[model samples]
Target: MTTPNNGDTVTIDYTLKRGDGEVVGSTQEVGPQQVQLGAGQTFPQIEQALTGMEVGENKVIAIDCANAFGPRNDQLVIDIPRANLPPEPAPQPGMALQAQQPDGTPMTLYVVEVGEEQIKADGNHPLAGEDITFDLTLRDIKQAA
Candidate 1:
């Protein structure tokens, strides 16, 4: 049995859940995912957990909120004048908008409040400030060349 190591390509099936036990993401919906160990394609915590795991092994990894998505920042929630938003499609609560930061990096902002004069947007990840868990099954390993 081959064990996964850094640089190896591994196939894994995983179900992700929040601290509240809410099922947030799963490979069942998208199929097994291939991750390149140490390539930074996935979370570092996951890569660490996969190290030395043989095919067909199962493991559950827990990540705290700070290490998962980082803590939420109050400054990330900002209110913009309604006039600044595009008139088409009209901004609505729960809508996600693509915005460019001052540094030219793209950011995803979620609409939290739609007011008559101001629209509230939160730049934090939806899962920010929440602990997450990953139930993983190592399905296959392709040894690095």
Candidate 2:
């Protein structure tokens, strides 16, 4: 059987678990994730580690946030005028909201603090700075057409 190589398309079933053992994501629970090997589509460590594994073989690997979603950046936190928010009561702290860019891409922001005139929000991923475990099994592999 031909093994999957760099640039090959791969369909994989995976479970992502946090350090506390909470399952943050599972393909078996929601189906599968499609990616291209060595294409920077997924974690570099995961892609590199699964290089030679055959179809149907399951492997477990751990990756830090730096190599996963990247470290939390303090610069990503910002404050916006309360008037800019939807017409509602003061924004609640610890709520996630989507802010659309001028280009139409939506960015996620986590509310951290609220003031009568402004609201503090952080754009860091919730799992940033944490190590996660990835259990992956190759469900399908195909050479690039």
Candidate 3:
């Protein structure tokens, strides 16, 4: 009956959903999520919710995009010349393409439209600007050193 406090390690199985009740993510499919309480590995809202839970506890969390991945930025979506794309992949609309930032971090861009000479790329997080709910269960809790 060890309850989670700050600095404890907690293992959880979670499912993420949209406000419309659509499933967004799940540990039941990808495996349970493991994190250290108060270690900043999760969203602040989520961490706050786990403050009092113990091993085997389960809870559902609802949060807005600002508390999740943050709001979407219109500027992140840009149009790039089609010629910039590799000739082999043959860019197509709706395709998820990997683009890089100036610092070399990889970004995911969806092909909004394939034009005669340009392709649209959006750098927003897929879950950005969307309100989401997370259903999380604590599978394990360990005390910190």
- Model 1 CA deviation exceeding 4 Å by range: none
- Evaluate model 2: give its lDDT: 0.85
Evaluate residue 34 in candidate 1 and report its C-alpha lDDT on the 0 to 100 scale: 97
Ranking 2 against 3 by lDDT, winner: 2
Candidate 1 whole-model C-alpha lDDT, 0 to 1:
0.94
> Sort by TM-score, best first: what order?
1, 3, 2
Cα lDDT of all candidates, in order? 0.94, 0.85, 0.85
Model 2 bad stretches (over 4 Å): 88-96, 100-106, 112-118
lDDT score for residue 74 of model 1: 91
Clashes of each: 0, 0, 0
Candidate 3 residue-wise lDDT at 76: 92
Indicate which candidate wins on TM-score. 1
In model 2, the worst 10-residue window by lDDT is 87-96
Model 2, span 27-144: residue lDDT tens: 8788988889878888887787667778898999988777777787898899999888997655798888899867998999999999989999998887887789998898888887
Instruction: Provide the lowest-lDDT 10-residue window in model 1.
Output: 1-10
Q: After superposing candidate 3 on the true structure, give the runs of residues whose Cα lies further than 4 Å from its correct spot.
A: 92-95, 102-106
